[model samples]
Target: MMDAHKLDCEAAESDCRFIVQSEDEGEAIKLARTHMHEVHGREVGDDELREEYLQVV
Candidate 1:
């Protein structure tokens, strides 16, 4: 069976910290990362100019 508590924690982390909202954190992380790259010109999500996107969901 799936672990409810684990999923809840992961969901919250993947959503709040990263400003990412999705039914799938894996996909969401990739999306957020990609957006970070295109919009910020930083593939590693480390744009100090926009440090807000410097995190993976």
Candidate 2:
């Protein structure tokens, strides 16, 4: 079975409550980054996203 990875925006910032989960960490981060850019109008880097947003589950 694939291990699940998660990204919870609420964990990083209380005002933004976005959550994304996927079997692959790369996929989760891609979705989270897109969400941040499209929805929040913030372009976040991959390194920063992985460091701040990604959580292995």
Candidate 3:
């Protein structure tokens, strides 16, 4: 089976319940980073994103 990862924007206290899932942790981080920047106007760094958003599933 492929690796699974998840990220929930709500965890950051945003009104967005947007949850992103990916077969790779890197992909999940990229998606979450882009979403935060485009939708929430927050540009989060990779380390912070990994620590805060990226969740193994």
What's the candidate order when arranged by decreasing lDDT?
2, 3, 1
Residue-level lDDT of model 3, residues 1-57, one tens digit each, is 876889988999568899999998888889998998999888899899888778888
Per-residue lDDT for 26 in model 2? 83
The whole-model lDDT of each prediction reads 0.42, 0.87, 0.87
lDDT of 2 by residue, 1-57 (tens): 877889998876679878999998889989999988998888999999988778888
1 or 3, which is superior by TM-score?
3
Off by over 4 Å in 3: none
Task: Point to the candidate with the largest TM-score.
Answer: 3
What TM-scores do the predictions have?
0.41, 0.83, 0.87
Q: Between the candidate structures 1 and 2, which one is better when assessed by TM-score?
A: 2
- Score residue 13 of candidate 2 by CA lDDT: 65
List of clashing residue pairs for candidate 2: none
